[model samples]
Target: MSAVPLEAVVIGASAGAMEALSALLPALPQNFRLPVFVVVHLPPDRKSLFAEIFQAKCRVPVREAEDKEPIRAGTVYFAPPNYHLLIETGRSIALSSDEPVLYSRPAIDVLFESAADAYGPALAGIILSGANEDGARGLKAVAAAGGVTMIQRPDEAQAPDMPLAALAACPQAHILPVAGIAAFLQAL
Candidate 1:
């Protein structure tokens, strides 16, 4: 941790998102205080079952993010399919139907970058397994804003491209296995 009290967490994952998130989200204790915002690449035409799926496994409340909703502590908010999830300056959720980034609507970069702007040093950004380089710049933005940045170890990822790109963009990020990342979040 950067000695700055973290107010929120932003996590981006793809390819093996379900497995990676399963290992991480379920580990947060029921009393975990920070609100976690997650973006997992999903087909634009399909409905996202992420909130329901993770709700059963996680101790915290899990729900699909709603536009203009106030952020709540200990909640896990998953970006809705086909929309770009953004963190507003007022700490509220904003959904956009804007053109996709890196070929994904709910791009990891979109969420991470917006959250970095909203929380700055009080943010923690995490990049996990994916097939594309969507999160590299976002992780760099978080680091530049003095926020904590973490990436799953490339060797442990189902698809290493995302992690590798992030590492190349922001070498200062903590590189850890899924289990190690889980433990770090639990200690926060």
Candidate 2:
């Protein structure tokens, strides 16, 4: 892991997430180097076509996570519609039906916590548009673990609550507009 510069990147988004992700994913170039792990709030009990939608626009491969499946670089995984995706050693994922946090099954905290423990400072965590406080604590945990934290500027967010909560909780978070965020990730 020490040899990998940045071990992995994690992202959390909700509410107006679809729109925010649509912009960010397409901005990442083909052959982007790092692995990306994401958590997006979705209505449980309904299957999402998000993976397919993103796959078409993203240069990186995208898939719905399968239990115990190993994570891989240049590929994006969406937590199964009703399940929370968790991290494990070297690319593997764990699925859970445990109760929702902040009213979200695939809660941002779950993904951010697991990724923080797994990657530590080698991690980069991003919080985008949303309507709740789901990702705030998780982003804080990531920063406390020595990782870089980024939040979409509240003014630019389609739903500012999430980003505002995140900034309030993680004061050090780098607040950037959507396009600035896309550019920052590209530079990394």
State which candidate has the highest TM-score: 1
Cα-lDDT of candidate 1: 0.94
lDDT of each residue in 1-188, candidate 1, tens digit only = 78689999999999999989989999999999999999999988988999999999999999999999999999999999999999998999999999999999999889989999999999999999999999999999999999999999999999899999999999999999999989988998
For each candidate, what TM-score against the reference?
0.99, 0.95
Error of 1 at 42 (Å): 0.4
Backbone collision tally, model 2: 2
lDDT of candidate 2 vs native?
0.86
CA lDDT scores, all candidates in order:
0.94, 0.86
Worst 10 residues of 1 by lDDT: 1-10
